[model samples]
Target chain A: MNAAYVNVSTPHADRNISGIRLAHNRLKVAVFVFLLAFLVTAARTVELGVRSGAVEQSLALDIVVEPVQYGRADILDRNGEILATSLPSTLLQADRFKVQDPVVAARQLVEILPHLSYEKIHSQLVGKKGYVELARQLTPNQKWAINALGNPAFEFLEDEERIYPHGRLASHVLGFVDVDGKGRRGIEGFLDYRLSQTDQTQDAIRLSLDIRVQYALTYELRAAMNAFQAKGAAGLVMDVNTGEVLAMVSLPDFDPAEIKSTVEGARFNRAAQGVYELGSTFKTFTLANALDQGTIDLTDSFDATKPLRVGRFSIRDDHPKNRILTVPEIYTYSSNIGSAQIALEIGKERQQEFLGSLGLLERPSIELTAVGVPQLPPTWGKAATMTVAYGHGIAVSPLQLSTGIAAMVNGGRLVPATLIHNSEGWQEGKRVIKPSTSRKIRQLMRMVVTKGTGRYANAVGYRVGGKTGTANISVVGGYDRKAKISSFVGVFPMDDPQYVVFALLDQPKGTKKTFGFSGGGWVAAPVVKSVIARTAPLLGVAPKKEDASLYETVSLMIEE
Target chain B: MRRMVTGLAVITAMASGAAVLQLKLAVQDKTDNVRKIVQDIQVDERAIRLLEAELAYQTSPNRLQEQSNRFLALMAPKASQVLADPSSIPERPAGARVDSSIDLTVALEPEVKKPTKKRLYKRKGAQL
Candidate 1:
């Protein structure tokens, strides 16, 4: 068959050979392409395998890393104590169409969560609506227990609930959030935007408040308030140099956890919001203002032998000293006559400017939304000047008084009162008064505590110096002598003032222990003394023996 | 040589296909593991937050004060009790020794003697 085919196809051999060669070339090309594709795939596989180890390790690590959603950043104290936080909660919802037995499910739910009323659950379950909320703020354990019931209709929506673990502690500062997680009051209201901003990496908001110090202040203030039978009370502790409010308490404070239980009166932040003629505490500012302006020297004398007559009003001291009182004597005796005379010496324009520079003639610039504007006199006449010098005509918040006093003692620098912790050390405040003036004021304040009306506020070794202000509450057309605002503004370690503690009792009644006197020395000074003694050590203010030179600088020799 | 090359190519193709399949399975397993671990971590984080809140609530100052008043009869420290300087603290009495170890069983024992129960009696002066 081969010989016959060869003989017949000799002429076509060339064409057959050419076709065969073409087919062979095509096969070679196909083999080459197949080999090339396989090699490329193999190389890719090897490369992927080599990188897979890193990818595997990352995958394993990813399992342990989970994003934490706080919803709102936590509010923490200076010591990192959690003041306010958010906890994960589940809101249980049910589809009415899918529920097998509404009555049974409701009964079961009420059994698991006794806080939810059976009636409310039943109504929600059997409602005509397609979907209904069964319960909210359910814990993980509760969610699991409910899920075990195998009800497809039931669904859980993950949510967070803001919780204040400290209850009423620092409630006025930390404030409370509304149902929709909107900040409503205090720091919550002031820095709500920053707190609610969606940045999980952001750290908790650290406030200047120290819980330990707050506890001490609150305990003492409450005790004093109860003992005096006062209508309300407020207290604040602030860093003199940094202007950081360590502790601020305004009673009758309400629990932030239960917003509905809070009364309207209880919600008032007395320290920063309530404006009052803070009585004798104003005398410190008056004396400091005079000293700062160099209008009055420490040896300057004023006759307090008789009540000073100014138009229809007569400015008199509660504890009358029928003699010529020097500048130190006036401060120590809390002589209204002396303070008024000093105010006259300073003049109206200078007094207003001085007070304005100290941030007392305007609204206190704090982080709280609830701040009171100073109720200045309609006209700055002689009577208004005299009355304001004794802390009666002009009304300012306790925060302003503390801030002004802080400026006077803290080397005459006007440090703005701040609720946020200043992590960048002591802020450089604008110079409000001369350093020498501040030093003289400190000496005078120390003398007041050592020998005058503020003696009760003297803490041993702490060298507490302060002034007492007990002003009659102004009523329509007249002042009610019985209802007085007793307050004390105290600075401790007077040689170098670090903190200012201001405490006040509104409409405090006289008690037997107080010798039937609702004066600041009797009612408020003791609170300041107690707070200082307790918190000074905690604040790390080392106590030293009173230096003889320091006493001599502020001491005044009274003539008979 | 051609036959040998074909044989080698087939083996290489088979091995590479198996390796790719194995790698795909391993990747799937790792991904599932990572996903599971992430879920677990989330659960744990939630639990930790809840615990922290509960702990804070339990240890709140007000509640502690109330408990101390009721159980321990503890009172707040007075200003006089707070000495300004540690050096001002009076020296301990002679022969007094510091004991570091706290015996809970002994410490837990009541400090005060329990009051005796009063006997019930009928009084002729008092009318029921």
Candidate 2:
């Protein structure tokens, strides 16, 4: 019985051991599977954290990159109005290797772009193995027509074209870019480095111009030019205190986009680039300088009884007051004889120094590239001094004259004229004359409008004070007796001077309305008057009742 | 006890791994959304620039002057038409009815005049 029980127990024990071993093997397999899954998951997590980030970063870079290249930034007016801008235009290119037939492609292109020469397009596409630009600056219609052809040989390249929307209104100011997108003239050339930075995200350059004022000035000037049958006209409006040019117009002006068709004379900026002998306007400078130097006073009288004889030159007034005229009378009447005597008193060296101080002897320090260098006499002789006193021997641009006049009236500070809009009301500048001298000069200018040649310049409710300058155009040997440069420089609300509006007409023939007189008072004064009347309200200058005492003071001064 | 600890460790690791995977996916989605938004913003900016240029061209002073000459009765304000002070405005005609709802006196209060220095002058008849 013991042997049989032992056998049974041994068998049971063996079977139990076998079952445990099998269970252990299954557990081992399960543990291996679980470890493998954990390893796989850990590796996937690492890949997502490290490798995927790089992939996503490269994908993001690819999505963000743009192929379009913007050329230059925009040019805006002081009021944030667009003066010049770059527009995205399509350029058509052709691949000769891909072309099925060059004749067909050129024909289709010419139909789309009528302005393009078919011969030129055919020549460019016939033998060009690489890509060749068939036409550039294509209109949207042209681009669509080319696209409709669905030619594999054609490709569209993105490009930028500069456009001026106002068209000849501020042409001299905005200028034009060349075919290579390089700025060629005007503000475009002056500020090329700043404008052509190619930064896609940058603010536009804001000029000091006011477009409304510019339009008003140009309209009045053009109307006057047409009415007077003048050869050309130039006008400028500037802030007296700040030296900011509000408007500058030179006509006949060219459309900036169609520069190739315009004549070279149309491209000349008469307001800034052409130097002329601006006549009696220089009297203001002489008188102001004399008063500042204490060499002459308002009560001092000059001999205008005859043509002032300085050697071979005879300085005679256009409208001669043939008597001993006081300084105020000389300025108001624009007496060239009296002015020559006063300049003789100032002398040549002092006169040169004074004009030099006024920035009249050097190139105008404005932003435009086409500024004219003032033409001075070869020898600063006595005759030269007398002639220059009445504005004959020395030639300066209208811009320089305006600047000098502004300094004489704007509390005696010679502020440099600027085309950039800084938004500051007044600019600090070098003092060229005493404030007392400036006040006396203002009084004299007001006297001109009140009692003298600038009577037509007085706009109603705006105290327009100015001087009229009618200079004869110089010819080969002498001055032309018929053709003249008639100009007026007027400042409005004369009590507190704000703006200088200058109008000039070159070779303006006498109109029937002007009674056969081609003088500054008749031709240019009316232009300044209309400009002040139209733009003063827009410039936010309010109209006030006539100050009785101010007129009384001016009248008393004139009487004295 | 050891077996239980091992099972607990494995479960915790798996759960944390799943959370991390979900977080990464959410981050990627947000990044993609941000990229799309940036692209949309750039597109809108370009559109706005183009529209502004168009508006400027349409309302340029030259064009407006032409349009006004053609179609409008309005003119630029004259110097006499502009007044500095509201009190300086002329009174309404006597027969015109006043608006009862609005009080205009507060807006039309007269400003005090500053004292000015007097000058010696003989007065002329009908002088301004």
Candidate 3:
């Protein structure tokens, strides 16, 4: 009995000990696995921290793509009015292989787009070609109508179309573009690359033109041209201080919208391109040169008892005083002999130097490609000098004449003409003449308007000052007696001039209005007066009272 | 013991892998959503540009001038009419009287007014 009990107890004790050993082994295995996992997680965390910056940079590089390109920029006027702009349009094309019935598609397309020919579209679609253009520049409404047809064969291509909103108002300045979106003429041609740049964040290019002033100048010029039965006309209004062109109207102007319909003569910009021998106007320059050089004084007198004969040509005054006239009297009476005498005193070298300083000897440096080169003489002999003194030998564009006059009046500064608006205030200009000389010329100009040939240009309270020039148009051999280029250059409130207006009529006929006289005073000075009367209020130039001090300041001393 | 340890490691690896896969899918979904929103913004901008151009064309100065001449029959103001100083404008004459009898309220009243009970009673009393 003792042996059997011992056996049972021993086996039970042995099994219990083995079970305890198995549980201890399992705990050890669990700990070992957990420790390995912890070590791996810690290593991975360190690795991620070390390389995180590089990974983020690579991801950013992968995400960002190139920016899309939008076509051309806009051109705005000084008042933020749209001069030229681009609008999006669609072009309709067809895939012939996808078309179920070419006839049905062509018929439906013609219905929506009446301008397109059905037969031409049908031929294109039914031909061997896989693709064909149906219409270009489709309006949004038309595109919607075509899309509603649910034709799988049709596809639309997007494009841009340039438009001028002002029509013929600033045609010569804004210019027009070709069908391929290339600039053809005027400002459009001059600044093509800047206009067609892909970046659209840039602001619209602003021009220096004031539309209201432009309209007024064009309207008056057209009216005067029609009334006088003239061949053509040109007018310009410039800010004397800044050389900013307020208005430039070359009549017989073409509508930039319909460039093909423009006539041959209408495309010529006479204000800057047509060179003419502007008569009596040069006398102002001659007198200014003499005064600037101290070669002649206001009290100096010249003998105009008879027509002065120089070499082969004879110089005579239109309204001869026929006596010894002082410098003021010569300018007021518009005497050629007196001007010739002053020219002789100034000599040839000084005359050329003065004119050269005014930028009259070279091509006008305007923001236009249609500028004309001055017709200067090859030799500055005594005959050329005398003739040029009265504006007979040297021919220049109206733009040059206006610019030179602006320099002489605007405190003797030669400011280059520009079409772009200068937002940073007035540009510093080169001094061409003395301030005193400019002041005296202002007085002479006022004297002409108040007491001389430009008496008709007196716009009541504006203190108008100017010189009238009527030159016979030169033919092949000599001057044409009947055909004349009548022009007037006027400055207002001459004591402190702000604007200079220059106008010219080409081949103006004598009318019964002025007893058959078609000179500058009759034909062009009235145009200047009308323009000033219409545009001064718009330009914010206040009219002086009837008896303003400006009248006394620019008053001339004459020996009547 | 060895089999149990192998089982725990495999389960942990499978769970982490599934979580990472789910996170990647969510990131892709958000990116696609951002791209769609950007595309929609581009379409709206194009439409706005088109409308702006159309508005400019309709309000062009030349067209406005033509319409004014035809419909309004207005003439251009002359220099004499344009007084530079506001003080220069002539005062109204004493003979010109303001007509206080003009009742803009009556003109603006609806023709077919629905009468409330109070309004109808007031009207009956006025008629009587």
The candidate scoring highest on TM-score is: 1
- Taken over the whole model, the C-alpha lDDT of each candidate is 0.85, 0.85, 0.82
For model 2 the local lDDT of residue B96 reads: 96
DockQ each: 0.31, 0.29, 0.15
RMSD of each candidate? 6.1, 9.8, 10.6
Candidate 3 C-alpha lDDT tens digits along A388-461: 99898899988889888988898889898878887775756998889988888888888888778898888876
lDDT, residue A470, model 2:
92
Preferred candidate (TM-score higher): 1 or 2: 1
Provide the lowest-lDDT 10-residue window in model 1 chain A. Answer: A57-66
Q: How many backbone clashes does candidate 1 have?
A: 1
Instruction: Output the number of the DockQ-best candidate.
Output: 1
How does model 1 score by TM-score?
A: 0.86
Candidate 3 segments exceeding 4 Å error: A1-69, A93-135, A144-155, A546-556, B1-128
**lDDT tens digits, residues A46-128, model 1?**
78668766665654533446477777988888988889998867898898899889889988888889889999888888778
TM-score of chain A of 3: 0.83
Which residue pairs clash in candidate 1? A280-A469
Q: Give all TM-scores, in the order shown.
A: 0.86, 0.83, 0.76
Docking level for model 3: incorrect
Q: Write the per-residue lDDT of candidate 1 for residues B56-113, one digit (tens) a residue.
A: 8887777776665444534444445566577877899998976768667798786774
